[model samples]
Target: MKVLLHVSHLVQWDIALSNSKNLKAIEAKSKIEIVVNAHAIQLYRELSENLLQQLNELENLNIKVKLCRNALRNNNIEESTLPATVEIVPAGIFEIIKKQEEGYYYVSP
Candidate 1:
């Protein structure tokens, strides 16, 4: 299964991450991508050690962490400052739609 997890609000970070983790645990063969956009983009720049560790854990589980380039630009966050594990997409909405077209299940948590 392919899953697209969306995080648009800052408060959704923990819920999104937890949802991703739970999905992986429930199905080991699932392909999961967590796409962070909008105000949630600040989570990347304002990462606490715990948050960073959780993101790293997801990477270790082979989950893709995607950041929206437009959001980053709007928030004034430098790509160089983001964690190396993340992949930046041109737009979050575009990415989500593309993934859905490709048969990934979309979830906003």
Candidate 2:
């Protein structure tokens, strides 16, 4: 099973990270893809040094973190500030819809 995580809130990173850490707990799990937007982007960017290290570890675990291009533009966040692994999606909501249409389980955290 593929999971599409929609991260719209900053504090939800705790849940997202916890879920990522326990991926095997999911009833039917194969691949996990995380799509982040809104304030989550800023939180990821402003993570503490230790938290950043944890995020890097998560990245190595094959979690794909995506940022919404529209949100970045609206918030005046420069793309360069984001980690290189973070992809810019055209629209966060649209991305969620597309992922669901493609059979990914959508979760908001």
- Model 2 residue 88 lDDT score: 89
| Tens digits of per-residue lDDT for model 2, 1-109 | 7888888887887788788778745643467777878877676556478766866877777787778998888777888876676788999889989989999998887
TM-scores for all predictions: 0.94, 0.84
- Note the residue pairs that clash in candidate 1: none
Give the winner by lDDT: 1
Model 1's alpha-carbon lDDT is 0.90
Q: Which lDDT value does model 1 have at 12?
A: 82
TM-score of 2: 0.84
- Model 2 deviation from the true structure expressed as Cα RMSD, one decimal place: 2.2
**lDDT score of model 2?**
0.78
The worst-scoring run of ten residues by lDDT in candidate 2 lies at: 24-33
What 10-residue stretch in candidate 1 is worst by lDDT? 43-52
Deviation of model 2 at 59, angstroms: 1.8
